[model samples]
Target chain A: MSDNKSLQSSRREFLGKSAVAGAALAAAGSGLVLTRMAEARAPDQPVSNKVRWGLLVDAARCVDGCTDCVTACHEENGIEQSGHAETDPQWMRKVELKDERTGYQLSLPMMCQHCETAPCADVCPTGASFIRADGIALVDRHICIGCRYCMMACPYKARSFEHETVTKQKPHAPRGKGTVEACTMCVHRVDSERLPACVEACAAAGHNAIMFGDLKDPNSEIARKMASEPSRAMRADLKLNPGVRYQGV
Target chain B: MAKMKNLYYRNIEGTSPGYWGLLGALALMIVAGLGAAYYMEHHGHIVTGMSNQVVWGLPHVFAIFLIVAASGALNVASIGTVFGKQPYQPVGRFSALLAMALLIGGLIVLVLDLGRPDRLIVAMTKYNFKSIFAWNIFLYTGFLAIVGFYLWAMMDRMVGKYYKPAGVVAFVWRLILTTGTGSIFGFLVAREAYDAAILAPLFIIMSFAFGLAIFLLLIMGIYGATDRELSDSVLRRWKNLLGVFVAAVLLLVVIYHLYKLYITRTHGIESFILLNGGVYTSLFWIGQILIGALLPLFIIFTKLGHSRFWIAIASVAVIVGGIAQLYVIIIGGQVYPLPLFPGMAASSSFSDGVVAHYAPSLPEFLLGMGGVAIALLAVLFVVKVLDILPESLGDAVLNPPAAS
Candidate 1:
């Protein structure tokens, strides 16, 4: 008789807790609807020019031997080395620079600068090479034709051709043989309000040399830094207005 | 003036064993070239010497040479029909046939070399108006159509009046086509070697030299094989013309390099090509200057100029030199390191600050040779089927009947 009474009391307690949880959810749902009505935009919209993605690299803080960013990019993009050094595709790489006069040396990662007026886009025969609304330069493989004309046109030499057939590929980054590719600024992660793999890895390694943010927002950290510090674009004489900027070289 | 009725046009009889042997050889070459192309497609471009550093290779050199030569071959018809030169009229039909054959060969090589040959439909349908390559698609196709009409106009007496008009249109079209080809490299601002506008005219002159040299060889070979009598006067005129074109090409090359040397920014590339570029420097001086230009010029201008054999040798030399020139231009242009940073030296795992290396593979060489074979095969087949070649290109047939 005591066991039966204990089971009945436990069932009664569960019913009481369920009633209170239901009431709380109802209230929260109404609040959420009201919040949605007050907002000016939808949650799922296409990328727009209102947000211009940019990267600010602090050369002073960029460690000479740290390859965290390059490693992160390769891992994230599924770029593999084919053991052929000269023919293999490299979307991102670290360049070592030495001062001719003083023998001082520095190292920094180099990639597609994502220029507003990209030469690759201009020379592409099928209009496959294009700049996104958010200023990321991209090649639409559907019509690229693999002529390598865009590769010849790029000034940074940032682009690479897949010389061999590719088997394994990340779903978000589709790479194939005979097409040209370059850095996409991790557009997939950026869409989900997550930092790019390179930027995240740089920070995780404690260097904190790379900053990625919206260049259009004046109050954003990257914009504020650009305004305060005298940063320059690579090959500024080309006047390509690259989205990526460097504070020191 | 009475219309001449004795100018006979007869097709070649293909019953000879030698003719069949020639055809068989060319067929084998085409099959090999196709096989190589298929291998490249299946295995990817890694099989070829081309890399991210050297994007273009020996196949490009061959394709460009043939394409440029095709445009120049049309000049004979233009001079005869459009310019109203009497002596060139007898060879006009053959000239048109040669142009068509060469262009078809070049187009085959270019199409086969594509990274995705299957996507040729996309290349045709999709249009990038700003791109010179896109424009070339139209130019190339238009050339084939115009030349076809020009050929018909020359061959058929019914459309004889259209000959001059067709020739004029074809002439203009070819000039534009060659300019477009040259502009493919010339418009590239990233490469220090190719930015100049002069490449347009330079290519025009190059076509004249290369096209005429091939034409002379073809005429000599055909006449020799058939036991046809080719007059010395006719041969001499062609030799002199070839010599003048070769000299013009040499002068333009000198001017192009000299202009580049004057620019401070281009000094690095200039010095690399003229002095420090190891293999490229030797090719420029020896292959292009000595074997290609000077030797041919010497042979054509000397007492040996009277000999048909020496003239033929001179033509062969010009062709060799043309290949060497294109090699330095196409491959050499890419191997040089791009100056990404103005003053600072750059080092990367990708060979950023150093010169890139390239060596053409067997497949590339075979594919290039295949393009040549395709041209020869086309000429062989067309001559056997159609009455394109005249019975005699002698002075009697060349000059009109002294105005009745």
Candidate 2:
């Protein structure tokens, strides 16, 4: 009986070792392929100042009563609805406008303009609020003490504070309670050379109102369009030099 | 010198049931406040009235008021030692003590209300040098230290000579401190209600009025509780000074509003605050102007000012008015929608172009009251342990012949 038990134990050990070796081999193969793919796509480098990402919104093409972009942003960012409209965090929203005298109406999506000199970054006490080399304003949650001073300083009112504890957070966007957050312009996707969720969603919905590209790259489609068309920055009087421009508004 | 030699200071016997009851109540309030703060921190600020729109609420108002009053409280010491006013000299020590107490109280509220209260150590360590909030941490701590040294110099005969220099340093430091506080709001160019240079001096004048009112009330309360002899002359002088300070504040308010009204860009904000801002407008006209400014001014300026009861009423009025004024400034400023689109009405899910509503919850009110209780309790504890209060504050003791 003892000899039979030892034989069974040895057989089980051998199977476990084979399984471990197979898993390790599979992981190594994937790692090598991923490295090669990354190297082939672009140099593994930090965000550089060479590329200044921006968005151009054609208000004329933007449809009224459609929130595909807003919904896409919420889903991509994992921003939940807490059933409290007044206190929920909104990274992006559709703003409806009406000219009082003209009776003309317009609809456009508003988010962080990603200014060259952001007021939110200027007022952050711990330097937790900062602008990246690529001119993306972001709050470093590690350092953000949640004073909300940045929200008060924002000219566009683009920032929102996470009032409730966030249970589910997207892997790319780490959100929690007692922190300030805003439209990152989908920095995660931007770094990966992919369009922001909102921009893609807008395009998918056939509005094609939003255009995303590098402002620094003159040959870029967005840059060419901007050069040809007259576009205005919201609250340009503040001299924020917002990356987002609007046309036909 | 003869009167000084005759004057005696002693600690209060804190054995009475009444004294114990008062201490117990204050301690209870402080504990309640801490509990509320902890609940808010654990549950998140969603439990409070503060939101993305109205970022600051009742606690900020209380904290700012206490801090402003603290700097103003030291004015008595400055007048006595720096300006060489003999009559004001007797209250200098108490002024320094109260200043420290009020500052400690205000700072507690400010720190506790933070979303990351546990990261207070981080705030102390890391700093954005350009930020006014960073500058204020240094200003607040420095004010406490300077006042502490000034108090020692005044109380200790060995370092008595240092009193004048210490007083001068503290006076200058306080001016800079109050200026920094005002600049917290004044420097916000995004907000139409702020971004004015006059706000600095306006806050200074406000500090003078608020600080004097609080000081007067403390002195009166202590004197009455101890059954000590307080001169009618000193009370009357303080009353007159308070009247002058109130008038100065009212004048500054008028100028600030008029300046906002004159600017075309700020006209919308000015009209909103003064006319169409429903609760805010009423708070300005009825709460701040009538109850806070006008009634207090009337009490202090009239023959009723002679009575201690009336003077106390005026002090209470001033404090009430001060809260109303802050509410209008902090909450009212936020409720007025930002003009994202000029000549166009904006509507959004984010409450854009609509006045944001705020109703401070029980926890916020308790937290603010806890700050007030902490200040009072500190005074109580200090007086019980140290001979901070004089046995009698009669005219003879206050105005010595040698000092004159």
Candidate 3:
């Protein structure tokens, strides 16, 4: 029995070492393939305006009574409701709009439009509300005095004031009571060359209503769709030039 | 009514039981306000009536009224020195002091209502130049400094020569200050309820009305308490001025509404404020128009309003009305949903197309009153130590027999 145990231990050690080496090689090969598949931002490099990220929503394809995107978004951002629905922080929501003349109803997900000239950033007394170089609007919660001026200034009703203390946030997303917050367009995922959780979820659910790409890149799917489709932003009269646009609204 | 060649100033006798009672009451309110602020900070804004929809609730109504009235209070001093109005000269010192007091009170309420009051330092350090809210920091603080200097020049004989120059600066600064205040709302192109340049002028007129009401209250409270002679003739002049200002505010309100009515796109906002806005409509018609504007105007001009008692009543009415107007302007604009889809209706869990409801909580009410208490307490205490009030504002001293 002692001789059998020693032989088995030696064989197990060799197999463990071989498995570790084989797994390391597979990871390296996959990493190289991923690098060629999509370019991710370096850790230290500053975000640049060269890549103007945008989202294109096809209202026609956005199925009514479907909230897969909202669910996926909340899951990805780790947003938990405190049961106060009226004052709860919502990074994204689905709104149903009806044509006044024709009563035709369509539902589209609504979040921060990420306007070029954001009123939230403009009215922020502390400059805490700002649009990133990559065209994502964000609140620098550190400096946010939670004046709610940004909430008042947002035309799309895109912002919500965090009314209660938030605990157990996702590692990537940090939220707290008092400051106003809204959609970040999944900046963490975008920087890592992945689609927003909502966009990926929408495709997975087979609705395929959402499209994500660099708007400045004319060859991108979003740019081509925006050029071909009759997409228009809500409140176009305000002239905010939003990065997020909807088609067939 | 005319200004006396030489004005004599004396400190109020602070030993009176009545004066002590008033001070004690004000101190109580200040303490209560501080407590309310702490409660809010401890729990967060969820405790307040304010939601994502109604961001600026009742505290704003109080704060904006006080701030606007602060700028208008200086109008008295401006009238005396800048316009060479003699009757207003004796009251210039009190006017400047009241302006500072009102501003201090308003700013206190505004700051305490902020979400992260601890980060007030962040607000002071960060400056977004494009923001009118940012511009207001300079306007509010500068008004205090310039007015403080103006007061020193008026009260002290050493810098008496610079009184008129300083008055000119303060006058211009106050005007710019009110414009900045008005523009805070007017520049919000996102909200249809605001976004009008006419709001700037409307605010200036409002300041005149609200400021004078507070001024009248101070005069009556001081002179009435001290048993000083406050003749009806002087009261008559002030009432007439109050009447004119009240009328001007009414006219501007009409014009602002007419402008909104003419624009077909703004029809929804117009309907909200004028017709279907349940609480808002009531406040506008009953609180603002009838009680605040018309009733005060009637009391100021009519023979029935001839007594000192009637003038005080009118002033209180204006004060009440000013708050109502601000409530309508600040909160009313917010309760009406943003015109996101234009003619189209949008529905969401966020109350996108619906009228959001707000009922100001007790803590909010107490917090606002606390601001008032602080202002009143400061003004009254300063009067105790300094010769801010006159020995007499009698017709004889104001318009002497020899001068007449």
Candidate 4:
């Protein structure tokens, strides 16, 4: 019995050693492949090579009373208004425009200008609101302390407080009270390699006022737009380089 | 094992079963309020009437008021410790404890209102150096801890003297605590109404008024429950202090507003809401300025200050007014919407551009009520445990059960 037990122990040790060695070889192989892929895709390191997203609204193309984009966005997000009865969780909303001097009426859809350096995240007591590595601004409701300090800090009034009791009956995900929530650049969809809801909505509306592509990729549509068109962010002076850009408002 | 065993079985000395029963009811209310808060936490803030437009709601108003009241509650301790006044000593220890409890109660309620109550530690971790609100968190935490130790030391001295220097240090710390609380709102550059440099000093003055009022009520309530009478000298002196502070607060308020109006006609919707715009106008004019500030001033300044009955009534009035004043400071700032969507035109209606508006929903109201209950229960517990009331009052309760 003692000899048989010794033999079994020796066999187990040999098998464990081989398994570890095999894993190490596979890991090394994958590591080299990943490094090569990264080097091939990497852009040249330049001082201003970082993609600073911008928008140029063509005011002439955007007319008054056209909420095609806004409606599409609401439907796509599946936002419901039960208690307060508002598109209060609007990722995009149509705002009436006025002439600087004469108060001329116009309408334009507004959404998150996922800034390069977001003030909302800076003032957040919890790091719930953060600028992603990819340059999209997002609010992680998981860590937010609903102090509303971000609301005061955001100059564009882009964010909204999701106040009101949520219905337990709805096929909705959990969100908490007191924390600030806002546009996430359709990060969940982006993770799944899907286009942002706003981009899809605008395309569906036939206006194609919005575009989404890897700004870093020179071959992407966003890169082409950046090269050809004159676009501006909503508040350029504050120096928050927003991700979303509006064309021909 | 011993402590746990005693916790369930033991009754505090000098209190009856009836008192404990009342405390139990208050405790139950607190539990129910907490349940509601948990419900909101799991569900979403969408349960409340808050919106981006009116992002701040009733909880914020209550929280600010409680914070202000906490500063005010430190008056007795300040007088007894800082100024070396003997008359205020009777209520000093009790007031310090009350201040800590009230501040804690306020903080817990504020935490319940946060969307991510789970990330409360984040408030401590990610400190925004520029924001007054961020600083307020550290200040409030420090204030609570310091005051708690201060009270504990004072109680220790009464029980068995151990540390004299710690007491001295605590006394000095209370001033810094009050100053920090004042700076929380006073240092805000975001809103025009709070931009006045006079706000911190005004906060100190208001603190005295609020502190004195709280001190008086607690003192009187203890005496009532214990059937004791405050010394005539203690009553008269506190009344004088209350009068002086109220007058100063009134004067400073006038100066602050006048200076603000003079500087900018375009202080945005906040100024309009206070001056010519909406319901807040009446709230500011009547509830805060007139009844809360002026009328209470009249009572304290005149012969009514000498009268115990009138003084008590005035303290109650001052407390109510102080609460109203805090609401004006906090909620008033929120009532106005940003003029971002121009030519979209600002909402002239009080509710228009305001993205979010919330009154205390049922749960919120219950939660607030639970806080009040907790405060009451705390005062009740203290009156029973320590010799908080005067020796004369203890003797009265001991000698006669029913006869006042």
Q: Pick the candidate with the highest DockQ.
A: 1
Which digits, one per residue and each the tens of the lDDT, describe model 1 over residues B1-404? 12444567777777789999999999999999999999998999999999999888898999899999999998888888788876677778888889988998898888888888899999999988898999999999999999999999988989888888899999999999999999999998888888888899899999999998999899888877876656678788888999999999999999999999999989999888889999998888898999889999999999999998899899999999999999999998999999887778889988888999999998988898899999999988998899988777666666546674
Each candidate structure's TM-score, on Cα atoms with residue i matched to residue i, is 0.94, 0.92, 0.94, 0.76
lDDT of candidate 4 over A1-249, digit per residue (tens): 889999999989989999999999999999998787564343443223344333334444664666666665555555455545431565566666655577665556676677776767766666677777777777777667777877766656667666654334223223444556566656556544567776676667666666776677777778787778877666464566677655543
Candidate 4, B231-262: lDDT as tens digits: 65557777878878888888987887777667
lDDT of 4 at B240: 78
Score each candidate by Cα lDDT: 0.88, 0.90, 0.90, 0.64
Query: Considering only the true interface residues, what is the Cα RMSD of candidate 3 after superposition?
Result: 0.9
Cα lDDT, model 1, residue B92: 84
Q: Report the poorest 10 consecutive residues by lDDT, candidate 1 chain A.
A: A37-46
Q: How well does model 2 score by local distance difference test?
A: 0.90
lDDT of 2 by residue, A1-249 (tens): 789989899888989999999999999999998887674345457677888889999999999999999999999999998888888999999999999799899999999999998888888889999888888889998888888889889988999898888988999999988889999999889877789999999999999999999899999999999999999999999899888999999
Q: What DockQ does each candidate score versus the true complex, computed on alpha carbons?
A: 0.74, 0.58, 0.69, 0.23
For candidate 4, the lDDT comes to 0.64
Q: Give the clashing pairs for model 2.
A: none
Q: What is the TM-score of chain A alone in each candidate?
A: 0.87, 0.83, 0.86, 0.70
Give model 1's TM-score for chain A to 2 decimal places: 0.87
